[model samples]
Target: MAKLTAEIKESLAATKTAYFATAAKDGTPNAVPIGAYKLLDDETILVSDQYFNKTLANIKENPRVALTFWGEKGGYQIKGTVTIHTSGTIFTEDVAWVKSLKATLEPKSAIVMKITGVYTIKPGPDAGKKIL
Candidate 1:
């Protein structure tokens, strides 16, 4: 697993919105903006499933996922494997965390992503290069 750098950790906190991508069994790609997401540690990223239908379904079909976000400086894309927690301590914690940010929002589940790769998404000569 690739550990998140200090810069990327700061970027995640500063980023207002992040894009999460997954694929269906048929290879259909799905990407959506997720506002309720955070880094649990260096490698683990948790995304609260407020209201996901196709996204949830796609996760079951394929575990591979990617998340991209941009801060004031630049953007990054992280590729990883996913594990969905429907009912557990993680789920409970996620609901509480999301509720603290968005009181009225209902959290259905938590999507836990284990970072395996990292890449620069910023537009430059280093774009698309794997940093980890």
Candidate 2:
């Protein structure tokens, strides 16, 4: 089974940039650039405010999602289902949660996701995970 590694956590926490992939009802995948996503736990993730777009809507209808992070060396791909949150709650009811999304610039428009699995891609120069 896929597991979250220290390296994966480091990359996700260190880089604030990622591309979220959501699919239309027909199963066509749509990818967009996003900057605010929080790993609430080993399986939960939070975006921000009304920041959800097609991807968000898609996730609401179909919880399946793919979130990714990349750098000069390599990157990790996180795929999971998002449990929709339409309004505020104890977790996202303060500036601290708001402050975490400063990377997004538009902190007010953010959406979070709950990750379920972590996939290693472009593993290394000598070894790599097969993209299947």
Candidate 3:
């Protein structure tokens, strides 16, 4: 697992939305905008599934996912494997977190992503280069 640097963490926190990408077992691609995500630790991220249809189905087919976000500091693409939690400690925490943000929104599941790689998305010579 790759640990996220402080700079990358800050950038992720500053980002209001992230582009989440996933693929089916047969390699069909799907990408969606996500706003309910939290950095659980240096190597983990928690994402709440409020309105997921195809995304959840793709996750069931393939656990690999990529999250890309950009902010004032810079941009990065995070590649990881996910575990879905519908009813457990993680899901309970996700519910509380989402409720704190907005009581009206209900999370269907909690997606825990374990970081495997981090790459630069910033335009330059370092673009697409793996940093961790």
Measured with C-alpha atoms, the lDDT of residue 108 in candidate 3 is: 99
Give per-residue CA lDDT, model 1, range 1-112, as digits (tens).
9999998888888988999999999999999998998899999999899988888999988999999988775679999999999898999999899989979999999999
Q: How do these models rank on TM-score, best leading?
A: 3, 1, 2
Range of the 10 consecutive residues with the lowest summed lDDT in candidate 1: 67-76
Candidate 3 residue 77 Cα shift, in angstroms, is: 0.1
Ranking by lDDT: 3, 1, 2
Q: Model 1, residue 65: displacement in angstroms?
A: 0.4
Model 2 alpha-carbon drift over 4 Å, by segment: 1-3, 88-91, 94-96, 99-112, 123-132
In candidate 3, which residue pairs get closer than 3 Å at backbone N, Cα or C atoms, i.e. clash?
none
Candidate with the greatest TM-score versus the true structure: 3
Whole-model alpha-carbon lDDT for candidate 3: 0.95
Residue 22 Cα positional deviation in candidate 1, in Å, after optimal superposition: 0.5
lDDT by residue (tens digit), candidate 2, 39-67: 66665666654355677667767768888
lDDT of every model, 2 decimals? 0.91, 0.64, 0.95
